[model samples]
Target: MEEANETIVAEFMLLGFSGVHDKLQMFLFFVLLLTYLVTLTGNLLIVFIVWVDHRLHTPMYFFISNLSFLEIWFTLVTNPKMLLNFLSDSKTISFLACMAQSYFYFTLGAAEFILLMVMSFDRYVAIYHSLQYAAIMKQRLCIQLGFVSWVGGFLIISSWMVLVYKLRFRGPNVINHFFCDSTPLFQLSCNDTQLIKRVDSILLSSIVLTSLCLTMISYASIFYSILRIPSATGRQKGFSTCASPLTVVVMAYGSCFVLYGRPTGYLSLEINKGVTLLNTVVYPFLNSFIYSLRNKSVKLALRVAFSHNKTKLFPKLCCAP
Candidate 1:
């Protein structure tokens, strides 16, 4: 009956790893801090190499760069706060800040799904339509695809934000989980959440399934085409090109489906906290390493880029007197 701001709890305490021993919490704080730094550096490095080196001036690298750019924002949304929560006695996030956190995280997460789908499609075109790959996935089209991917996430998540706002939160504002995730936020709502549950399930299922089906179809055609290659070496190379994105697709979708795909939300918040920890933190950290280490082109680009920088630095240092 009261106004929204007055009705809602002033702040929600994020019981992030509070049950753990003080020693382990401090250890976790440093570990998470280190992982966050590495994730930023690795993703940034990918974007930098892709931008500075003309050798990476292609549709594939452009998409890869967009993905790395997305990861920077995606991981940033939660890792810093989580680190603070680990060390500080106050693990509290204000109501509006909590909502903003959920909005941005899901928005970026959806963008990730779409961008990954676009990446798979890019691979499909590159392999299946090799003769026309350059013309088909040109700079103009790549820009358009990247634009759609980013904008699409904003559109998809805006509705979820609306639904979240409609729900009333009335007290006991201690969330058992680390971050302001949908399920935990849902659990806190005083109103009947059947609609939100259904909406959450539908939206999540639609995004995951739609992207997955498209990716599968692309890979299926790609597989058939790759096998049709007469040369054994050619076949190997074809599969090799797809390995990185496919692995990423599996990790991203697999974690979501297991953790948050249900109509009722996750059955256990404690386990949700654990798995989502891996999802939010470790996954981004791994994605950069996976892309750089697996892709030969990226490795070569890294070597060349760093070597050139080192050479230029050496000249400056030697001549400085």
Candidate 2:
């Protein structure tokens, strides 16, 4: 109602971390740059390895490659802007760009969240019901699952994007966080966002809570099956297969629980900014590290690739004598 009479703000200012200590912003810039580099490199490597190695052509690796691609898109959508904000005193974002930024970030992130649950479910099926794993997660089924994730993410975030665009920004135009999160975007609007916030809460709870519960259930079954392996070594190997994904799910959902579960007015902008940045950057880096270091296939692939490249480059040297 109020938005009908109000005009949309031309631009929004990102308050960012400038309100904090004097030189800490510089520190954050480099730290975040390092994080971005690692996240990009790691996720890229996963995609590369999965693509190049024919051994990784299973349904599980298919989902992993999609997840890896999603992370790269996710980081690209948010981190570059945040990195730029660190150096620029004026962190101004156009109304359209802000909406676009928030949309892709929300969409990719939600998809990744759901994708992780799917991956966990895949693992559970494999560990708990080895015979049915392939039958259950067939190529067609994997395609459907991936499609559903992308569709669900886009539809949900797009609805919010429309809701956000309709609001009038007659109030303060400064977003307290590094990027255009829902809370800060709503905060700048002249409209009463009570209904919007409620709708957001319901959607978030369903997505975050339901997905987390499913992941937990999958893991519970996997753990139970692990225990029945009879031999200690077999049990340990089974658990080790899941350890990395479990750790990532915990960190990601843990951060979301804190950031999203808070009352809109009660949120600490600085903390929310830091958490978002860390979540996007940390998980990708860790996923890359975990998959590369722990998975023998990936390491072996890398070693082979490297040796082949070296061999090509040093052919003349080898025959010089």
Candidate 3:
């Protein structure tokens, strides 16, 4: 009977902020829709700017482009479905769909984690070894680092996905979050999940701790190098360059630590939902803004692109007989 019940559960209902009032839900729908559009536009613009501007063709821009690309898919995996659920009465996701969402969510998320660390290292190299920065961070090396971030992140989370796929959901099919996160899924599993929980703790701790430590070390070295410079201009320039990546790291790592740093049982669902919303929806928007505002190269690229487009359009309009 237990086995039959497990097999019978084929779909999971996502209870995404269902406790909110109707008016609040409607307001949230438009708000999230606007956020989605802005996130897409901002990240896509960064990608375009990095690709077309030869002057901005450095290792830093290359990594920024890759990070922008990752942010696009990262928000896509869950935000659209969440928007749909805001309007629909039935917020059910299939077993397969949930699994796919979870996989992509973790994949892009983990990739961003490593990518940010890589960006930190790039800064360290640029500041600490300015003379050899070009030689050290050649095109080949940049591409390889980006590739490793994506592939390594995927590999790290693949085991968790496998374990999740094997778990059986028998009775309660409701997930009390926006998307198919492992925490809620674990709660609904009929099988013993002690091993899965332990593995999750180990993996999350190892990855987050290692990445955080490396990022810290890179920044510490970077600051030490900056302080030793005699010129205030050089010190200011160093701080300015590191600002964007540092902001992103703080937001990304802070949210992650709050969400996954502790045992799942200790977290409140409401707090988790809010934190997840900030992490998934708000952070992408913030990331793009931070980079664009702080990085002069990206700002120049944007200005050049816009001016070139306007010039081309103006000539065509004015030439119309």
Best by lDDT: 3
For residues 1-321, write the lDDT of model 3, one tens digit per residue: 346434557888999989999999999889999998999999999999889999989999899999999999999999999999998899999999999999999888888889989999999999999999999999999999999999988999999889989988876899999999999998899889999889888887777888889999999999999999999998998998898899999999999988998866778999999999999999998888887866777898898889888878898774669
**Per-candidate clashes, comma-separated:** 0, 0, 0
TM-score result, candidate 2: 0.93
In TM-score terms, candidate 3 sits at 0.96
Instruction: Give Cα distance to truth, residue 8, candidate 3, Å.
Output: 2.8
Give the runs in model 2 whose Cα sits over 4 Å from its true position: 1-7, 20-22, 318-321
lDDT of 2 by residue, 1-321 (tens): 244666557888987777867588788789889988988988898889888889888877888888888889988987898889888878998888998998898888788789889989889988998988878888899999989888888887777677777877865788887888888788677789888887788778878889999999999999999999999999999988898789879887987887887776566666677777678777677777877787887789888877777879998875677
* Segments in model 1 whose C-alpha atoms lie over 4 Å from true places: 1-7, 263-266, 316-321
User: Given candidate 2, what's the lDDT at residue 65?
Assistant: 83
Question: Pairing residues by index, what is the TM-score of model 1?
Answer: 0.95
Q: Whole-model lDDT for model 1 versus the true structure?
A: 0.88
Q: What is the TM-score of each candidate against the true structure?
A: 0.95, 0.93, 0.96
Q: Which tens-of-lDDT digit does each residue in 148-236 have in candidate 1?
A: 99999999989988999777788879998788888778878888988877878788877778988998899889999999999999999
Candidate 3: which stretches are off by over 4 Å? Answer: 1-7, 316-321
Residue pair clashes in candidate 3: none
